[model samples]
Target: VKIRVGNGRVKGVDLGYKVIECEKIVVAAGEGSKYLFQTLDIDIPIVIRRKELYVSEPYSLFIDPLIIDTREDSLGLYVTQTLRGELMGSIDYPEAIDDLTHETTLKHYTVYAKKLVRLIPIMKYSTVMRCWSGNYVTTPDNSHIMGRDPEWPEGLYISTGFSGHGFMLAPYTGFLMARHLIYGETPNTMEPYTPDRFRMGKYVRESLVIG
Candidate 1:
């Protein structure tokens, strides 16, 4: 996909061979968003990281409800027994050595095993069937970046830098993004999350991010 800017305004985007023209563009490209914006000479302050997860084979139902460990050292270690009787979870750890690969490590397994076993002793016996990793889009403040880019071509909006809470906060983010883009409704609550804040050295750091 390619962005199209012309005549001092965004003309929409070029999707492969097709050009889908529009008045505005909302770039919610997650971890790749920084690169995407760079093509247009806009700098997004985002850091790319990787997170790992593990899943257990089906077993008899025992534990319920999503368990979250809110300790600072293990801020996002969470585990839950799915309805299918499988236990699934992940833990927050230092960023991977390589930021571009979804490589899983024994370190993730070893650390998560210790945390899960402490929460649910039966997890010690549960068979871990599979593990995987994915990318995370982080920011200096760990909060989101929203609204239009003041220096970019007009009609460009960004709603990324979600850290790791994008899924949980999608509905709210979508709502604010839609209203801000379509209606020019810039609420006072959103002032703290603008990308310009980073340029001005103002950060709204959040400490509750999960893995």
Candidate 2:
């Protein structure tokens, strides 16, 4: 659903321009962040990409937490072990998706399933069961937008453009952002992802380990 935004006030009293009635706002808007910043009128140049994942299993199971490989430009399959010793896998494809449906692709399963099975060395004889897609947002440098707005410390704040790595790092990002919101200060660790870096031509590319 779409949330209608207006001048932040009610009963003829302006509550500091933003009516959220809080000291700060951390915008972890996910894929919708592409349109979310329009509310504040900041051009944070990013794109929303649709992505797909796959699930499958053999009669037996193997493996651990999600696995990824940057070379495929798609999600490397992750194997999950079931109680009955069957295997389930999830894939993160890199191809741009056009819609939000979790549709499965045959070619994707055909290519990634076998590789996942091979990684564990026990599924060379198994077949894939399912696959799906979802939405993702990314930026040119793969860094996140953090820190207080220089001109609007009291006006607004946002945190988006996670690319695809936010899920794994959100726990700490949340703690760090929450501290910034409540205390108005963040450590030097988060200083690199200033919101205005893109506009000022000051951007740092993230390490390729998790790309």
Off by over 4 Å in 2: 1-23, 58-94, 97-99, 114-124, 151-154, 209-211
- Over 51-136, each residue of candidate 1 has an lDDT whose tens digit, in order, gives 99888999888777788987766637898888998888998775663287788899878988988888777678778999888887
Error in Å for residue 20 of model 1: 2.6
Question: Scored by CA lDDT, what does every candidate get?
Answer: 0.83, 0.60
Model 1 global lDDT (CA atoms, 0 to 1): 0.83
Clashes of 2: 3
Task: Give the CA lDDT, 0 to 100, for residue 113 in model 1.
Answer: 90
RMSD of each: 2.5, 5.2
lDDT (tens digit, per residue) of candidate 2 on 80-196: 666755565555544654355556677766666656755666566666566556665667787777765565434356677777777777888888888887787778878778777
Model 1 stretches astray by more than 4 angstroms: 69-76
TM per prediction: 0.85, 0.69
